[model samples]
Target chain A: MKQDQDEFYVGYQPKAPAGIAGAVRGTVVLLLLLGAVAAFLIVREQKDIAAALFEFGVVREFEGVIAAKPYPMLRVARPDAAGDAEAFSRYLLVAPFKFGADPIVAPFDGKKVSLKGTLIYRDNKTMIELAAEDALREIGGGVGDKPVSFGEVTLKGEIVDSKCFLGVMNPGELKTHKACAVRCISGGIPPVLVVRDGEGTVKTFLLVDRNQGQVNQAVLPMVAEPVAVTGELVRLDDWWMLKADPESYKLL
Target chain B: MSLAYQAVGWNRQKKVYDGWLAVGILLYLAVFMVLGAVLFPSITAETLLIRGFGTASFVLLHVILYIGPAARLFPRLLPLLYNRRHMGVSMFVLGLAHGVLALIQYHVGGDQFPLVSLLTSNGDYASVVNFPFQLLGFLALGILFLMAATSHDFWLANLTAPVWKALHMLVYVAYALLVAHVALGYLQNHAAPVTTALLGLGVLGLFGLHAAAALREGATDKEAEADNGWVYVARVDEILENRARMICAAGERIAVFKYEGKVSAVSNVCQHQNGPLGEGKIVDGCITCPWHGYQYRPKDGASPPPFTEKIPTFRAKVTEGKIYVDPKPLPPGTEVEPALIQGEGVA
Candidate 1:
């Protein structure tokens, strides 16, 4: 057939028709430009990566009493403590990846212990990642304080894995991180019900059963989802504890 | 045409096509990665890589799907359709990387097996918006892998053209799954309205292009009127020399070619990949398929010696200054004598 005015492109030909080459070049340029624009849109739309920090590779030594009830944590006494003042600053503790520090700190519960671990923090919350080899060294037995009970209340918020929300992962409490949160919670990481109190400031409450026991296994399906809980809110020094059964948490 | 497969027969056009493809992929990836790192400082390396490769592959898929309809709408864009398998394979590789990285980050080192965790972590399948988007992506990746694995001509030949074509058409299913993945998975959260709008526009645009191409093809595909056994093609001069005028008569698709004072007819469907031969040009004395440059003799509908491809030919004649072709097709590789166009000289 006679060649039309429009250049016919043959894949095996040594040279493309000039008109076809020009068209393809123009299309390629436009595609690249569109790609950059798409990238910009997607990157800009990303949830502002939280200002949380994870000391990924830095380990520091700390001394504190291991609080192994409800969740594993380190209760370091405040340096400027006086009579009738808040006594200890609590830091939630977890092992590497998706596990809570229960197995590591169970033996030293209520005992003053020292360990080398990394710190993860966001807002006012802190969590320590313990080293596997001799993670805890019990220095002495320490007195543990009972949680000061506040009245029962209802709160609405999302359930998030504490390790990731505090800092292991950025922007960690949403559908994007849902599976990770579920995996973490299922693997025994402490789950926190992230909620907003009357003052409108968002706070996280360490979630536990009605008897104040670990609820990691029971709260698996509810992680990273909007939920409402009616529970007794208590304060253990700086730590906020929510006493509620996992089966009672309502999906919202 | 190749006598035996040798991985790929490197042609200058293919090299140029692949070289530009690589450049486009790298440029997009670089922009996404470098810019994402700069903009989202707290994003992890694994997340960055996963999003980078995922977005790049997603973009490549759009372009790849765009080319088929674009080539039909504007023939000059056929060059893009030629090396499309390369694009498919590259997109699959990128998707695989994204899936593997995500699995390691979210599933590995957890309490359960990674794959089981991925499948069982979220039980909200009953909800449309909250359906596990990763599951959609996983299924799409599986489809893409199938298409990519069988992209070679060897597989095409072994599976036969009709089956291979049907198999590759699963790309639409894969594309739909990916769109759902982005919509219900990524956009289910705090996505900007503009991002959602753009996604909607992209889906609409893909459908629009396909509709437009189908509309353009409607005219040629319409059934033609026949007198006795032969059907009217086009006026002798209307079919430019060395070009074929496609005519759909009854159920058969015919291409009537006029060249050098002679007229010949052959099936419009090329033996290779069912490419539209009527849209092709006579190159080096053979009808060269625009899609892959597969050539067949105009008279006998057979590939030149050393290539075994053949297509059905049809009896044709130029009578009263108009070309007509028999609605019935001759056997594949059947040689039909060209009917002389009385007034035309050698073109």
Candidate 2:
């Protein structure tokens, strides 16, 4: 049935006039076409999803030296390293669900421990989300640390929550992921300043105040916004650490 | 159209309408998710669900808004308007899904409560481009929920037509908030041309359709004054058989229907949804409403036996080849004699 101006439609009637029923059928075809077009355009327009991987629900055991400076991290020496590069690979450690691994790993600071956790990695960056309980148990080895200084410099980038950016959330930087970044950072996850070089090479630095303490709360207002910070760039093993007060950061 | 509503009155036509509606929604979601995964192989499942549901609800809102004006311009499209409230409720449910899942994925399991974190997580309230866009979406969802909760005819009857109408008018407010939500939330980061173009087109199309409908309605809204206790209607010949010509007189819209060689006048507002009664033709000896087909006898403005709805009727007469209506209304259900067109006087 078509929508003839002459045919009156009473919805309570068991049947629609043939013309209206036919017109509604035509409308359905039209709507389906519109839906297809919308779906294609919308999906095709998405920003690229990053090639990050989060090995969610697959638990693996690991052994490494714990470090609490700047943020909680595990330093595992690599036997495959060539000649004078950093001897160990630093795996950022975070507790499950929007929290830092500091409290869980702090008791074993500077001591080697074994733990079960999930791995979240992107490019060269890696992080571990520790099991809810019994995440770290000391395996009995002491650690000595030497920090190499890269000198004071000014760099520009967006601040992001390290756990999410490492792999937990794809493209987890800037305004789109700002709220989650803020939540993660506020809950004590390390804040990272992510700088991308002109050629698209990316460098991430664990942000800390001048005292080398956690700056998660201090950097909340700057998370996911492009900003510039001047600080001493130092290296603790394979991890880059930015030593600066949150007050020195400027919105770009 | 309903004597007593029971959740919903199931009719064959209504079942067909809902079945098609479900098909449309499922088709949209399937396309979005399947195509999204094929295109962005690394896209997370949660992100896909969020985007698919969010965009579907937003697009459906544009369709819902378009129906009212489109039906006015093309009355044959009235079937689309018959079950519009169902569409509203479905749109709200989709929106709720998008909102709740996005919140859980982002804000929950954090140190603060999810709602608290949602409000306090962003401090850029003063900046337009940097405003908390999620907050806009949250507020819009709240309004959508309110509307869906009160959508039943039971609420319409309890709240009174005017108040229910006024509450639902907040759809424009909700629409504005959603526009900002998209502009500030997604477009601020993505800025894809197709996304922006679609949003702009929906806004512009709605504006164009409504403006055109309003202009057409303005022509018929011209008021006629009374002379010697009667208001002049159109010529008797102007109203075709079993059809009506509407006139605004005596502070009300009166439909002067000519049927069976005689003329009668009644209030133009239908008892159901206040549909334009004048646009409907006489069906089975009763004046039918164009929207829901609620019927009333032209002589007394009363529904047939077993239907209690009624409207005010006016005394009509034909004189010197012209039709005239008394500028005062008889009580609802009061019977009035039909005017003889050839004899030029009320029978």
Candidate 3:
């Protein structure tokens, strides 16, 4: 085919304009210098962010739990006068209770214990969720009810019934699945306990919250033993919720 | 034929462009190393230097690739096209710095050997949601390094143009790999949406321009083919004073210049990589390619500086107020300088 000789030509040549090579070299040098400076700044910035987060009390400390148990009702009372009396409360309509290894057990009528956890405020109220270590410690022993700071107040309570849930039909009989039911519930939701007043009247209480990939083993064989559960005390409606410290929990 | 038409053949290079390229790259590395050492004391200065250099190099490579296409679309951008290899090599150095630093950071930091860590660190390779894209970047960089290392004419001649071109095409693959690297590694880790978008837009913009050019070429191919052969159909006003527009005939584009009242015809494609000379400007008594600034004297088509390629020139004559170009090509490098007419010539 005849190639056009009157058409526009566009092609690439390896050579550059006079002095442009020098200019490009200079520009690259400048950019490299600038990049080094920027990289240093970025590294410093990351360190600062990490430090700031640490200063803000975001890093949690492991503290022992004083006490724990599952109660029929939970509540969080407002601290101020203007705050609602019943801000957060969850009442268990049915109690499917179980003891140590038993499949079924009776509901926690009246019990009391102190537990410890990291208290976090949400919607203007405190909520406590126990960590694994704290739950285990609380099951071993119970604690006394002392006016503890938001950080170290371990709720102490007796496991009125380890398995506490509504009655469910078994294949053979209508036998209560109490003890084993609590162990099977998982999520540190076993070793159910009841917090009670001086007159033995059931008051607010705490329960175990488990993490993923963990199973609730048999309750501390030392039943009725006092345990210190350090975590956050979350006050709901009629009863207060205690989340045990996953790290800081010990059998007293 | 004109002097410009005869100059479109390959000429041996007096000086290699690679020397300037190497020098520029080394300077960038030195500057990066010194600055990094001074600025970052906590981390090993070498690592920072390498990373900084690599990033800058990639950016420079991108800029170099853009200059050619930019000059084509915008004639004024020709100046940027000059000394592009130096720019490319400098970029290569920077990219090398990045690769070396990344290897040190990812591989050396861990307890395992650097190479082992690079290959076996699959901790973050769980899902597409969090795929380890760095491995892909590493692979792409390896390809770029290979191409950059062999970017000299010596290698080009040995490898042959087709092989060289094919090897260089890995640039597109590198671009894609880099995109994935940034998206999965940096963006995911930093969660910086704005930065991600900006980088994405810059790369996408370059690709978009190339795609647009390809579409335009396809659309104009038929007209170009018709204009390539003997008969040149042009508007009366299209032929400017002393300068001529290239017309496509029979699938070829040819430049027709009217100098001193005489019209001459030559292949519009530059002998050096078929650069379009018709789009070039007549500067300082020479046809200057808008791409890479290669100058050729229009009298004999001889490239002036840093180039020695010659293209075929065709005979042309005006008949009955119409322009016609001969279908036959003159011998390669035939210095057929067309004479100029002194009297009032056909406008």
Q: What TM-score would every model get versus the actual structure?
A: 0.95, 0.96, 0.50
Question: Each predicted complex: what DockQ?
Answer: 0.72, 0.72, 0.03
Query: How high is the lDDT of residue A245 in model 2?
Result: 97
**Where is the poorest 10-residue window by lDDT in model 3 chain B?**
B5-14
Residue range B1-347, candidate 3, lDDT tens digits: 11233212342221333454555456545555555445443333343454557555655565666655665565444444544555665676667667776564334422345566565443236667445565777787788788877676556546765677688778778877877776665455454454555567668778877877667555434454224445654433457654666766666677777655566667777654356777666655667665545567665676665556556766766555455666456754555645334432322
Please tell me which predicted candidate would have the highest lDDT against the true structure.
2
Off by over 4 Å in 3: A1-252, B1-51, B109-113, B123-127, B211-229, B233-237, B240-244, B281-308, B327-331, B334-347
lDDT tens digits by residue: candidate 3, A122-212 = 2222233322232211122212233222443665554322222211111000011122232233323333344445884543334444321
Q: Mind sharing the TM-score for model 1?
A: 0.95
Q: Please give, for residues B239-305, the per-residue lDDT of candidate 2 as tens digits.
A: 7788898888757988889999899999998876788899987988999988778899999999998
Candidate 3 docks with a DockQ of 0.03
* Model 2, C-alpha of A111: deviation from truth (Å): 1.9
Which residue pairs collide in model 2, if any? A1-A18, A1-A19, A1-A20, A1-A22, A2-A19, A2-A20
DockQ-based ranking: 2, 1, 3
Q: What lDDT tens digits, residue by residue, belong to model 1 across residues B1-347? A: 66687787888877887888888888888888888888878876777888889888888898899899999998878888988998899899999999999889888989889999899896488988779988999999999999999998989899999999999999999999999998887788775787788788888889999999999989999999889877888888798778889989979888888787898889999876999999988888999898988999998999998889999999887778988888888899999988889953221
What local lDDT score does residue A31 receive in model 3, on the 0 to 100 scale?
A: 47
